[model samples]
Target chain A: MLSSTVTSLTVLLIVVFLFKEGVGVFDKTAMEEGFVIAINKNNPVDKLSSEQIKNIYDQKIISWEEVGGKKDSIFLFRVDDISNFYTDEQIGENFEMLPYRLSSLVDSFPGVIAFFPEKYLDKNFKGKKLEADKVTLAEFFGGEEWFPTAHPSAQLGVKPLILGTLWVSLGAILLALPLALAAAIYMSEIAKERVRRIMKPLIELLAGIPSVVYGFFGLVVIVPLIQSTFGVAVGETGLAGSIILGIMALPTIITISEDAMRNTPRAMKEASLALGASKWQTIYRVVIPHSISGISAGAILGIGRAIGETMAVLMVTGNAAVIPHGILEPMRTIPATIAAELGEAPNGGLHYKALFALGCVLFIITLFLNLTVEFISNRKKAHKH
Target chain B: MYQIDENKVTRKKKRNQKFVFFLFGAMGYFVVALLVLILTFIIYKGASAISWDFITKMPEEGMTKGGIFPAIIGTLCLVAGSMLFAFPIGVLAAIYMNEYVKDGFIKKFIKQMTNNLAGIPSIVFGLFGMSLFVNKLGFGDSILAGSLTLGLLALPVVIRTTEEALKAVDNTFRQASIGLGASKWQTTRRVVLPIAFPNIITGLILSVGRVSGETAPILFTVAAYFLPKLPTSIFDQAMALPYHLYVISTSGTNIEESRPIAYGTALVLVIIVLFTNLLANGLRKYFSKKVKMN
Candidate 1:
C-alpha cells in the first residue's frame, strides 16, 4: 500500500511540477531581456502588441499611422544608432551622456521608437516606455515562428512544431494503415495456426526493438535510400521520419487489430460463412465491422506513440523548426524540439519554461488520444456486455 | 440455380480472395524483410568493430576509436540502479492492487493512473526527470538522477507485468492457503508469490531491456559524452549505449569518421535487447511448463 501510494503520488507530482513550471511561459513578455521599446513622449500610442513591433522591425509597418500614431514614416532607433544622432565626443566616454542624447533624439522625432536596455533609461527621460505584449495563447499556439532564443524578442510560436508533429504522424498512419490492417486481417482470419504462432512472437519482437535502433537504422539505410530514390538534396526528411514511424507503428497497429479481429464472436464468422460469403468477405463484412471500435482504438494509440517518439524523429526528421510543405521536407516535432534544446536552456529561464510549455502541449495531445482509446475500448466492452 | 454457384466458388470471389491474401501476405513479408535487413546490415557493418579490446577498453580519440566499455558499464549501472529502485515498488504496488484492493474506485483510480503514466511520452519523461531529479532535488545530472527518472519511466510497465503475473496465480491456491490457517500476508508470501515469481522475474528482465535502451531520460540526467574516468559514485555521469550511439551519429565531432563506432554501438544495444527478449521468452516457456507440471 505504501508502494501504491508512492506510485500514485509520483504521477501526481510530475503533472503538478510540469504545469507549475510551464504556466509562467504564457505570462512571460515576448520582448527581449532588459530591453524596452520607448516612444516620443508626445506620441499617442499607449501600448504595442508584440506582433506590431515585429512587423515594424521587419519594415512591414513602415508608417506610424499603422499603429495608431502620427501619419509619418516611423524612425526605428536603437542605442547603437546614437552616432547618427550625435557624434562620439558628444556621446562621451562610457556613453555617460548617451542617454541624454538618446532621449533628445527620441523627443525630436514625432514617429521615433527607441529600443534600448532598461538600465540606460532614467525616470525623467523624456521618452515614454511602452509595454510590449506578453506571450498570448493565440500567438503561442497559432504563431508560426519558434525562435525561443532570438534577440530583440524570443519568438515562442509553436505552430510549426505542432504542424510538424501533425504532418509526420498523419503521414505515418497513412503509410502504415494498409500494411498493418492487411497483416492483421490475414493473421487473424486467414493464416494457419502454425503461421500465426511463428509470426506473432516475431511481430512482438519487432515492437520491442528499441526506437533508437530504428532511428539509427533509418539514418543509415532509409535516409540514403530515400535520398537516392527521390533525388532530394537531403536524406533526413519528413518522409524518412514517416517511413521509420510507419514501421515502428506496424506492430502496434497489427497486434491490436489482430486481437480485435480474432475476438469476433465465433458465431458471427460462422453465420457469415453460412450465408455464402467467402472468407475474405466474412473478414470485411463481419469481423471488421464487429471490431471497428477496437480497430480505431488501436489507430489512435499508434498516433499517440508516433507523436511522442523523440530520438528517431530527432535523428531522421532533420530537426528543422519549419512547417513542412510536403512529406519530403524535413521538420521538427514537439518531442524532438524539447530533447534537442533542453540542455542549453538555463534552469528556470524563459527558454526552459517554454520547453516545459511545449511538453504541456505534447501532454495534452497524448492525453486526448489516451482518453479516446479508453473511450473506444470501454465502448467495445459495453457492446460485448 | 444455386448449385451452379455452389459447384465452384465464383471466379470473381476466387480472384478477389487470391488478390487480397497476396496483398496481406506481401505486407507481412515486407515487414519481415525490413527487420532482417536492418539487423544484418548493422551486424555486417559493425562486426569488424566488435573486437574484444573494443569491449574492454576505454574510448579514445573523441569516441571514434575506443571500445564502449564505459558506456556498457554505464548501461549496466543504470539498469541495476533503476531495477533496484523500481522492482520492489512495482511488485508491491501490483500486490496491493491485485490482492489487497477489490474492484472499486481505489483500484480503478490506480489502474487509470498506471495507464496514464505508461502513455506519457519518453521525452516528457526526460523533461520531468531533468526538472525534478536533476534540478529540483539537486541531484545534478548524475547516475542517481538518471536512474530515478528511468525507474519512474519503467514503473508502469513493471506494475502492469507484475499484476498480470500475480493474476496468473489462481485464486484457489489463495483460498487453500487461507483455509489452512494462513493469514492474508502469509497466503501471499508463502503461496501466491512463489507461483508468480518466475513470471515476475521474466517481466523484470524485460523491463531491463526497456530501461537500458532508453536514450531520452538519460540524455540530460546521467549521460556524458566522454568522461575522463569511470564514475565511482552515484553522483557522477557516464556514457550509455543508446545515448552514445545518438551522440556519435548526430552530434559527434567526427560523425563521418565515427560511422563504424556508431554501428558498433547500435549493434551492441540491439544485441542486449535481443538477448533479454530471448531469455525472457525462454524463461516464460520454462516457467509455464513447470507450473503445468505442478
Candidate 2:
C-alpha cells in the first residue's frame, strides 16, 4: 500500500515542485540583477513600456520623437559598446575607470540610453535611470519576446514558445493521423497472420528506439533533406521537427487504434459483406466507424507526445525562440526551451524559476491530454460492458 | 448490355481491391520499411567506428580521437542502478494494487495516477529530479540522483506491466490454493506468482530497455560532458550515452570531427535498446508457448 501510495503521489509531487520553483519568477524584476535602463538626464522622456523598450532595442523605433520625446535620433548603449568611444587605457584595466567614464559619457550624450550595472553610476553621475518593471504574469504569458538574459530587461514572454509548440504538434498529428490510421487498418484487417506477427514486433521496436537517437537521425537525414528539398538556407525548420515527431508518434497511434480496430465484431464485417459490400467497403464503413473513438484517443495521445517531446524537437527544430510564421521557419517548444535553458540557469534564480514555470505549462498540457485519453478509454470500456 | 455491365463491375472491383492494397498494405509496409532504412543507415554509417579498442579505451583529445569506454560503463551503471531502485518498489506497488486493494475508488485513482505519471514528459522529470535531488537533497548531479529520477520514470511502466501480468493469472488457482488450507500470502507466493513470473520478467526487461535510452531525465540530474575516467562511486557524475550523443551532434566543441564517434555511440545505444526489446518479446513468446503446451 505504501508503494502504491508513493507511486500515485509522484504526480502531485511533480506539480508541487514545479509550481514552488516556477511561481517565484513573477515576483522578481525583469532586468538582470544590478542593472537598469538609463537615459540622458536632460531628455524629457519619462517612461518606456516594456513593449516600447523591446521595440527600441530591436531597432523598430529610431527617433526619440517616435515615443513622445524631442525630434532627435535615439542612441542606444550597452557597456560592450564602450570600445566605440574610449581606448583600452582610458577604459582602465579590468575597467576600473568604467564608472567615471560611463558617467561622464552619459553626461555628454543627451540622447543616449545606457544599460549598465548600477555600480557604474556614482552619486554625482549624469543620466536618469528608468524604473524597470518587475516581471509581471501578464507580460510573461502574452509577451512576444523571449530574451531571458536581455540586459535592460529580460523579456520572459511565452507567446512564441507556446505557439511554436502548438504548430509543431499540430503538424505532427496531421502527418501521422492518416498514415497511422492506415497502418492500423492494415494490421487489423489486411495483413495475414504471419505478416502481422512480423510487423507488430518491428513496430514495437520502432517505439523502443530512444528519442535522442531519433533526434540524431533527424539531424543527419531529415534536416538536411528538408533543407535541400525546400531550398532553405538551413533545414532545422518546424517541418523537420514535425516529421520526426510524426514518426515517433506512429507506434503509439498504430497500437491503440489497431487494438480498437481488431476488437470490432467479426459479425458486423460479415454482415456488411453479405450486403454486397466489397472488402474495402465493409472494413472502411463498418470497422472504421466502430473504432473512431480509439483512433481519436490515439491521435490525442500522439499529440501529447508531440507537445512534450524534447530532445528530438530541440535538436531538429533549430531552437529559434521566434514565433514561426510558417512551418519552414524554425520554432521552439516549451519543453525544448526548458531543456535548452535550464542547464545554465543558476539555482533559484529568476531564469531558473521561469524554466520551472515552462515545466508547469508542459505538465498541465500533458495532464489534460492524459485525462482526455482516460475519458475516451473509460467510455469505450463502458460501451463494451 | 448484361455482358458489358458485368465487365464494368469486374473493373470496379479490381480498382477497389487495388485501393485497399495501396491504402492499407502499402502504407503499413512503408512504416516498416522506414524502420529498416533507419537501422541499416545507422549500422552502415557507424560500422567503421566500432572495434574492441573503441569499446574499452578512454576518450582523449576533446572527444575526437579516443574510445567511449567510460560512457558505455556509465550507461550500464545508470541502467543497473535505476533498476535496483525501481524494480522492487514497482513490483510491490503492482502487487498492492492487484492482490490487496479491493476494486473501488482507490483502485481507480491509482490507475488514473499511473496513466498520468506515464504521460508526464521526460524533461519534466529532469526538472523535478534536479529540484528535489540535485539541489534540495544535495545529491548534486550524481548517479544516485539520476538513478532515482530514472527509477521514478520506470516505476509507472513497471507497475502497469506487472499489474497486467498479475491480472493474467487465473483467479481459480488462488482460490484452489486457499481451499487447500493455504494462507493468502502462501497462495499468492506459491500459486499466483509462479504462473505470473514469466510475464513479469518480460515487463521488467522492457522497462530496462526504456530506461537506458532516455536522455531528457538524465540531462540535468547526472550527465557530464567530458568525464575522462570511470566513476568509482554512485555520487560521481558520469558521461551518459544519450546525452553524449546529444552533446556531440549539436553542442560539442569539435562537432564536425566527432561525427563518426557520435554515430558509433548511437549504434551502441540502438543495439542495447533493440536487443532488450527482442529479448523481452522472445521470452514472452517462449513462455506462452510453454504454457499452452502444458
Candidate 3:
C-alpha cells in the first residue's frame, strides 16, 4: 500500500508540476511584468507591436524602412552585453550606473532597440519606452514555427513539432505492426516448443537493451545505410527514426500479441483442425479472431513505446522543427524537442514553460495509449470470465 | 470429375501451406538475424577498443581518447542509489497486495496506477525529474535526483515482479506455519519471505539492468557532459555511460575520431545489461530447482 501510494503520488506530482509550469506560458505577467523595451529618443518608430518587435529582433526586419522608419539598419542590444557596451567598473560596483550608461547608449544609436528591467527606466532618460504587448495564448498554439529563442520575440508555435511527432509515430506503427504481427503469430503457432522457449527469452532481452544503445546503432548503421541507399545528402531522416523505433517497439508488440494468441482456447484450435481446416486456416480463422483484443493491445503498447521514445528518435530524426513532406525528410519529435531544449531554457522563462507544455502533451498521449490498452485487456478478461 | 476436383483441392492446400510456412518462418528468422547482426557488428567495431587502461583510467583528451572509468563508476552509483530507494518499498507493497489484501477497490486502484506508471515514457520521467527534484525540490542535478527519477521508473517493475514472486509462494506454507501456532507476521517473516527471497532478488537484478541502461532519465537530472572525475558525493554531478555514448555518438567535437570510443561505451553497456539478465535467469533456474527438490 505504501509503495502504491508512492507510485500514484509521483504520478500526481508530475502532472501537477507539468501543468503548473506549462500554463505559466499563458500568464501575461510572466513575460512582460517586469521588463520594458526602450528605443532611441530620435527613432522614428513611435510605437511597435510585439510581433514587429519580435521580427526586428529576429533580424527578419533588417532595415528600419520595413517598420516605417528611416532606411537604416537596426541595431539590437541587451543588458547583458558587458564587453563592447559597458564594463563592470563603468556600470558601478552595484550596477548603479546602468540606467545612465544604457540611456546614453540608446541616445548614441539612431536605430537602436533595447530590452531591460523596468526599474532601470530613468525618468529623464534619452530613450522612448515603447509600450510592450502581451504574448497571447493564440500566438503560442496557433503559430506555425517554433524558434523559441528567436531574437525580439521567441516563436513558441508547436504546430510543426506536433505534426512531426505524429508523422514519425505513424511511420513507426506502419512499419512495426505488420512485422510484429507476423513474428507474434509465428512464435505462438508455428514455432516448435524448443524454438519458442529459446525465442521468448531473446525477445525479452531486446527490451532490456538501452534506448541509447539503439540510438547509437541507428546513428552508426541505419543513418548511413539510409543515406547511401536513398542518395540523400544527410541520413538523419524521419524514415531512419521510424525504422529504429519500429525495431524497438517490436519486442513489446510481439510479447503481448503472442501472449494473447497463446491464450486461445485449445478446444477452438482442435475443433478447427478436426473440421478439415489446414494449420494456416486454423491460425487465421480461429486463433487470430480470438486474440484480436490482445493484438490490438500489443499494437497500442507498441505505439506508446514509439511515441515516447526520445534519444533514439532524437539521434536519427535530424532535429529540424519543420513539417516534413515525406518520411525521408528531416523532422523533430516532441520528446526530442524537450530533451534537446530544456537544458538551455532558463528556468521560469517562457521557453522553459513551453517545454513543460510539450511534456504535458507527451504525457497525455501516453496516458491515452495506456488507458486504451487497459480497456482492451479488461474487456478481454470480462469476456473470459 | 470428383477425383479431379479432389486432386486440385489438395494441390491448392499444399501451395497455401508452403506459402504460410515460409512467411512465418522468415519473420521468426528475421528477429533472430537482427539480434545476431547487432551483437556481431558492435563487437566487431568495439572489441579492439577495449583495453586494460581503457577500462581502468579516466577519459582523456576531450573524451576522444583513454578509458571510461568515471562513467562506469557513475553508472554503478546510479544503480545502487535507485535500488536503495525502490527495493524495500516495492517489496513491501508487493507483500501487502499479495499476502494481505483481498479483492478490493484499493488493490484494483493500486494495480491500475502501477500499470499506468510502467507505460509512461522514460523521457517524461526526465522532465519530471528536472522539474520536481532539480528545480522544485532544489536537489539540483545530482545522483539523488536522477536515482529518484529512475526509482520511479523501476517502481512498477519491482512491484509487479515481487508480486509475482510472492504469488508463486504456495499458500500451504503459510497455513502450515499457522497450524504450528505461528502468528501471521511471524509466518510471513519466517516462511513466506524466505521462500520468495530468490525471486525477489531476481526482480532486483532486472531493475538493476533497467537502472544501469537508462539514459533519458539521467540526461537532465544527474549526467554531466564532461565531468572526468569520480563523483565524491551524490550531490556532485557525474558522467554516466549511456549519456557518454550519446554525447560521443551524436554531438562530440571529434565525432569521427570518437566513433571507436562511442562503440566501446555501447559495448560495455550491452555487456552489463546482458550480465544482469543472465544473473536473473540463473537465479530463477536455481530457485526453481531448489523449490522442486523440497
Name the top DockQ candidate.
Answer: 2
True lDDT of residue A5, candidate 1: 85
Candidate 2 has an interface RMSD (Å) of 1.0
Per the 3 Å backbone cut-off, how many clashing residue pairs does candidate 1 have? Answer: 0
List each candidate's DockQ score.
Answer: 0.78, 0.79, 0.70
lDDT tens string, model 3, B186-257?
A: 998999999999989999999999889898899899999887468999898888999999998988899999
Q: Report chain B TM per candidate.
A: 0.96, 0.95, 0.96
Give per-residue CA lDDT, model 3, range A248-361, as digits (tens): 998999999999999999999999999988899899999999999999999999999999999999999899998779989999999999989988988888888888888988
Report how closely model 3 matches the true complex, as a DockQ value.
0.70
Better of 1 and 2 by TM-score: 1
Q: List, residue by residue over B1-294, the lDDT tens digit for candidate 1.
A: 335664456788988999988998888777777777878888899898888998899988988897899999999999999999999999999999999998999998888888989999998888889889988899998999999999999999999999999998889999999999999999999999999999999999999999999998899899998887889999999889899899899998988989988888888988998899899999999988987897
List per-prediction Cα lDDT, in the order shown: 0.89, 0.90, 0.87
Where in model 1 is the C-alpha error above 4 Å? B1-9
Candidate 1 chain A vs. true chain A: TM-score?
A: 0.96
In model 3, which regions exceed 4 Å deviation?
A28-137, B1-4
The native-contact fractions of the candidates, in order shown, are 0.67, 0.80, 0.73
After TM-score superposition, the amount by which residue A348's alpha carbon in candidate 3 deviates from its true location, in angstroms, is: 1.8
Better of 2 and 3 by lDDT: 2
lDDT of 2 at A156: 89
Candidate 2 backbone clash number: 0
